[model samples]
Target: MSQDLLFQLNGVSKSFVKGKEEISIFSDLNLTIERGDFVAIMGPSGSGKTTLLNMLGGVDQPSGGEVSFDGARVDNLSESALTRWRAHNIGFIFQFYNLMPMLNAARNVELPLLLTKLSKAQRRKNVETALALVGLSDRAKHMPSEMSGGQQQRVAIARAIVSDPKLLLCDEPTGDLDRTTADEILEMLQLLNRDHGKTIVMVTHDPAAAKYANRTLHLDKGKFVQRELVA
Candidate 1:
């Protein structure tokens, strides 16, 4: 294994039993992700892009193969161990800004830190830094309901990075915004990758959105059909 490799999925398969039929999401898939690479997974609905993201994030385990991260077998971990591992090594961003309506921006960004042993002062500083990174430092005290959709997503991004996780997994991070706002968010993601050296894997349906990534993998019926490098 090269030192730059961050994830290795060998012969990974995922299946679900729905009623009397068994549905295979991905069969015998092999993938490798390098550190500091921003990758986008693009496919139509039901192509299992999000499922693959869940696998990478350790939220879902493969049924038949191996998933390794930083030389550890992540797919073999117990549920509790996986949870702890995810908390420290993975950051997740969803289509919807998953912020609490009542909690202000700083508090929402502090939620993940509550799982760790950081002091209140440390958590506050982290929150401030994260919010600043996302260009929301002045809005740290505003409630989610008071912010626009784009601002809310920025807050969510702040929350995701507050812990400085190894990988940032985003499922449609700009799905709910206008084109201009979406472009801004994508630019921030680019800055995160280029300047901060954060590794990000995002799932997006829009071809324009996929262009922001270093490479895009196209999936069809649970299989990767193409790998395109961004020029």
Candidate 2:
């Protein structure tokens, strides 16, 4: 393993069983991601883009081969171990801001820290820092309904980064926002990758959203068909 490498998938394959048939998503797939890299994955509905992101984050496992992170094998981890590993190492962002409707921005951002042994004060401080980073410090006390879509997404981003995870797996992160708001969210993701050294893998169908990433990959027929240097 190279010191700079963050994630590696070698000979990975995934399949699911339907009513009476088996569907293969990917076969013998391979990929590598390095530290501090911002990568965008673009593909059609059934190209397995979201599956790839899920596997990378330990939300799903390959049927064969291996998934490794920082030189450690992740596919072989037990359920409980994988849960712990994911909580500590992976942050996820979804198309719809998945913030708890009842929780305020600060509480939503502090959710990740609750899994750790940090004191309440420490957790509060971490939440404050994350909210400030996402320019939501003043809105920390606001409920999800009180914020706009862009502001809610900002809260989601803060929640994702609050744990200081090694990897951020984003699935259509800006798909729910307007063009201007989407650009703002993408810019914040770029800032996190460039300034905070966070490795991000985002799945987006929009080329404009992919443009925010340094590298863009196109997946089709269970394979990566093209690669572009967008940044």
lDDT of 2 by residue, 143-219 (tens): 99999999999999999999999999999999999999999999999999999999999999999999999999899
TM-score of 1: 0.98
Q: For candidate 2, give the lDDT of residue 207.
A: 92
TM-score of 2: 0.98
Q: Which consecutive 10 residues in model 1 have the weakest lDDT in total? A: 222-231
How far does residue 19 in candidate 2 sit from its true spot (Å)? 2.5
Name every residue pair that clashes in candidate 2: none
TM-score of each: 0.98, 0.98
Q: In model 2, what is the error at residue 50, expressed in angstroms?
A: 0.5
Tens-digit per-residue lDDT, 1-231, candidate 1: 899999999999999999999999999999999999999999999999999999999888899999999988999899999999999999988899889999999999999999999999999999999999999999988999899999999999998899999999999999999999999999998999999999999999989999999999998899999998994
